[model samples]
Target: MIYKRLEFKNMAGQKVKITEIPVLDSRNPHYFLVHARLQALAAFIYNNPDSKTSYSFHDYLKRKMKWSDFIQLYRTEQYSHNA
Candidate 1:
């Protein structure tokens, strides 16, 4: 189940709107991959002084981090750049 929209600020200080937040399902086959991606995102946000969001990285993870969410956001940004 995807949640409501959320906002995040990237390292460049741009406000990125995320429209989907997938519920975490540990039983999913790709759970580990998703978990690792989320961890990497969290670490990047935490380590980069310029990266920020409405909530802290920890809070964001607890609230909205999931495989589908990450993949959706990634594809959206990627396609937007190319278009």
Candidate 2:
């Protein structure tokens, strides 16, 4: 897994730097699931400004998340906003 470093300004104007965005292999059976997870993570970061500096965000990405786990997190975040 080749990790890519990502640096961007969060919603709160804080610079969030992630150094472990995995470059998944296209031939992997779980490629789509992993891709979706990565997209969801990006959306999560964009939508929730507080996540910019959260320890959870930094730590969680360091360990690649399973598709189910990532989906659960994305859904939880969506529900929190709606509720």
Candidate 3:
């Protein structure tokens, strides 16, 4: 999931830092976690079956939902192979 492991300037021309931490979430079932900047947004991380590459996307929920609802939806969503 990490393309490069070095600190570099971001698009804003400011120095950005990169740190790699080994984190595991059993409830998520995925090897990694996908976090969204906004609570109202839904985030997903998808791993390609045939490659080391993975794809991800984030989108706003159709309607305002509770945290439990979001978790339930994510668990049922197609993108996540996790239970």
Candidate 4:
């Protein structure tokens, strides 16, 4: 497993810490689970550092989610918000 530390600024401009772990493999069957995982992770990261999961956005993208799936989801959400 790959581990990393990441820092991100929320809308409030406050610096946050996130742990990045590459745990997902290509053999994983529940690909759609990444969306919920990402949402949960984002929520967890926004809280206290001690409460956050040991994973990062980059790691989530690389491990749990495919690039095309992420892009499609993002585009769909963006379009819905704009519409």
Per-residue lDDT of candidate 2, residues 1-83 (tens digit): 35566677777788766555556578855567656656777677766887435333335643676666645434423356567
lDDT of each: 0.52, 0.59, 0.33, 0.55
- Native-structure RMSD, model 1: 11.3
Residue-pair clash count for candidate 2:
0
Off by over 4 Å in 2: 51-83
Query: What TM-score, computed on C-alpha atoms, does each candidate reach?
Result: 0.40, 0.54, 0.22, 0.36
Q: Tens digit of lDDT per residue, candidate 4, span 1-83?
A: 44445567654556766665334555654344754676677676665455333445665666656778655533423355567
In terms of TM-score, which candidate is stronger, 2 or 3?
Answer: 2
lDDT of 1 by residue, 1-73 (tens): 4344546666666665434444446886645755575557645654564433444333455455565655553
Q: At residue 80, what lDDT does model 3 achieve? A: 61
Best by lDDT: 2
Q: Lowest-scoring 10 consecutive residues by lDDT in candidate 3?
A: 39-48
By summed lDDT, the worst window of 10 consecutive residues in model 4 runs over: 70-79
On a 0 to 1 TM-score scale, where does candidate 1 land against the true structure? 0.40
Task: Judge candidate 3 at residue 65 and give its lDDT.
Answer: 42
